[model samples]
Target: MFSRLWPVMRKEFIHIRRDPRTLVVMFIAPLMQLILLGYAATTDVRDVPLAVFDQDRTSASRDLVEAFVASGQFAVAHYTGSDRELAALIDGGRARAGLIIPPGYAADVQGRRGAQVVFVLDGSDPSIAGSSLSAARLIGQAKSVSIQTERRGATAPLLEVRTRVWYNPDMASAVFMIPGLIGLVLQLQATLLTSSAIVRERERGTIEQLIITPIRSFELILGKILPYALVALLITLEVLILGTFWFGVPIKGDVGLLLAISCLFLLSTLSIGLLISTVANTQQEAFLLTFLTLLPSVFLSGFIYPVAAMPAALQFISGIIPLTYYLIVVRGIVIKGVDASTLLPQIGALALFGAILIVAATARFRKRLD
Candidate 1:
């Protein structure tokens, strides 16, 4: 088996070495994506542009504006004299949120009637809008509490809620996103490389050579996969190093366990690609098919969006995606540092996916060869 497999594997390595573009896609592209996406794909909304219309012109109103700025959640991008100007700022996208302090805000607070301030948020992007709204509420509540305490001559608050964040204390989005990015990049490259593998052989008329050889179908499949699997593993290692040292995302679990699970993930992805190669007569078709699978995997696999939030139908689709299970495992190992026992269910799912996909891909490839 090794004797027959060695040639195919060696030939693949030779092809990869000769193709500079493949080398770049395998190594350089992932790192570039990791760096670019790591910074770009963040959920922490800080310094949101704020437009303020202070009608009161009092110390209380000025203090409210200062509070928003000092909290680091908002920056006063425009100070407007009228409601029209504030509305214009929001319409022009210069401000994500608007604060309007009514004329009697100070008097209302002083009279113990409770001041009312209007906070207008741009509802175009719900994520940004929601975050800005939450922050605004918190700032407003804190400011109101301070004013109340001062008026009552109280040194301590009547109620204080202490909160602690676990796993990701700072709540850095990169810490949450990098592990998932690792899985995404790995699946992308592995599937693309293998999806084109058999198609490339057919396009170059090399499939005939493969067909005529005494190489059994299983041996051929193993040979086609092993080399790309190694390449995928190397890419995984490179991105892991970059994600950890460059992005400062710590690996809390056993690195060996992570790599082991990564291998299982590669098995599923490679087989899916091989299956694509068998179905697609041309490289373009294979590429298209790979993306068709990838798009749903990305959006529905709880990568950027929570799977639980997806509708039942979409959630069902996510369940079949190997990336979904792999992501749970990757995030578990990388971020939460859960033990093997804790990850047994995800591990078992990956193992099952790899088994089913590889077997199906082998059958399809063998049928095509015959």
Candidate 2:
């Protein structure tokens, strides 16, 4: 057993040393991605595009609008005259939030009658909307307190806030992040594993011998896939263990279901790699193609950005990426404690993607053999 794997392992090492792309994918990419995205991609929504409709146009109203901009959470993108125009800005995707100051000639505040300001948020993206809504509330409350202070000889009422959080009450960022990270890692590993397998063989001029061997196409493909699949599984288990033991991410739901569905997700990624290997002639070409696929899959997969926030075109593109369904499934099961029945739609989607890609890869592999 040692002798057999030693040669195979030695050959893989030679390939890795010879190919810079493989080395980057295997080692540099994972750590670099964790650090880069951990810092860059965040839910702390700021610099949100805001449309203001100051009907009264008084100093008071303008001051309120300025307060929003000064918070650094909102940037005034448009000053609209009519409610219709303000609505259009948000509807047309030009702005993420809209503010309306009712016309009272600024007398209401002076008369000590608290006025109401309407905040309209585009509800497409929940994450951005959450931050924007919080900012709006805080600004409104602060303004109310200031107005009261000015009128009542600098005395203000005491206010206390009681917060109750559900579903991850500890607010562990790890609990929210680890499942998605696992999905990302699985996709990267599975795709890179299978993507280079055949291409590397061809690059080393071993395809002729592989073709002449007394092995059917199915056998050859399975033998190639099983080893890489095992490798991907090991990486996933490592991530799970580190996440649970080191990061303290709780498994609130069915771990068995998580593992089962994860395997289904791998099928699509592995098949994508196999298809790339079948088409690509050079190891460099294979590496480039794999990265090309990997980049968009991560971006559009709702891994970092919410899919609802993306344009209609991109949302449609994301529907086809296997990682998208897997993220929903895994995150739902792990954090939300949702059952398999609740996730049937995502499960079916993953199954369909896996079936289609594996069939296509098999057909291509057979054609290459013939």
Candidate 3:
């Protein structure tokens, strides 16, 4: 068994070594994805366009305006004299938030009297605008507290923080997603598609011609995956560059470690694809099966939501999905800049997944041939 497997593995390696494009994909794909996703997909909300209507134009109103600017949450992009003007600014997409300081605003605040600041937010695209609202409200509440403390000499209202996000600071949703997409596109395209490559030849009566000669299944698998893998890798690079340059995402992590982990992830996904190919009767079947597996890897893998946020049962189920661990590894390396030593669990899980996939694929391939 060992002897037969070595020959096949060696042939596969040789075929892969000879393909330049596939080599590039195997090596360069992850980097590109990191760049694209990092920049395009962000959780941090900043520079929201704002319209202000200051009725009093007093020192307090001025101070409040300054606070909005300094908070880095809003840019005073427009100023309006009336409520209608504020509405117009928002309607024209010139502003996301509007502030209306009521009459006697400064006097009411200073006299330990409560004053109201009307804030109008564009509920359309609430994710971004909502974040701006939360930040602005926090700042306003802080100012109100200061005013009350100054007048009353000590009874300040309790502060309650309600945090909201725009893109993905904690979810790092882009970081988690892009890397997984790399695995998905490459593995399905390369593995399952290639799995049928040799079998299709057999179905077409050409495989026997090669089989009677010197060629092997391993060589065929290599030839099939190499070109597709390269394409996948190039896509990865495109994603990374776009994320970094176009979006201004910081690549403050270890590139080398990221690449290493990506390789493992690719290997596992590819193996599963290969395993599917062995069982599938046609390309359509293989495609369907790949999608069946892919859906679970995606929706169930905690790509869009937190595993911890999921029920305990679902979280446990997600533990077995290879992409789930890979998501953690890639996001951790890219966003948090975690090193290999610290990411041991994720790395270990990937390694184990790869081994299992490879073993299962090899077994299926042997049985299919038999």
lDDT winner, 1 or 3: 1
Instruction: Judge candidate 1 at residue 301 and give its lDDT.
Output: 77
Candidate 1 residue lDDT tens string, 99-199: 88888878877777677788887643344556777788788779878887778954433222122233565557777678888789989999999989889
Candidate 2 segments exceeding 4 Å error: 1-163, 367-370
Candidate 3 lDDT over residue span 1-370, tens digit each: 9998999999999977875544554454455445324433344567678889999899878888888899888889888899988866664446667888877887776665467777777643434554676787798788777766667674644222233332234434354456545555555565655666645665676655665656566665555556655665676677667777865555657877777777777668767777876766555556555655655555556565434334455657778988878766665555546577667778889999988987777666641243
What CA RMSD would candidate 1 show? 15.0
TM-score of each: 0.60, 0.61, 0.53
Candidate 1: where are CA atoms >4 Å away? Answer: 1-159, 367-370
Q: Over the full model, what C-alpha lDDT does candidate 3 score relative to the true structure?
A: 0.65
Instruction: Determine the backbone clash count of candidate 2.
Output: 0
lDDT of 2 by residue, 282-340 (tens): 77768767876777677778777766556566668888889988987777766656678
**Model 3 lowest lDDT segment of ten:** 158-167
Local error of candidate 1 at residue 334 (angstroms): 1.4
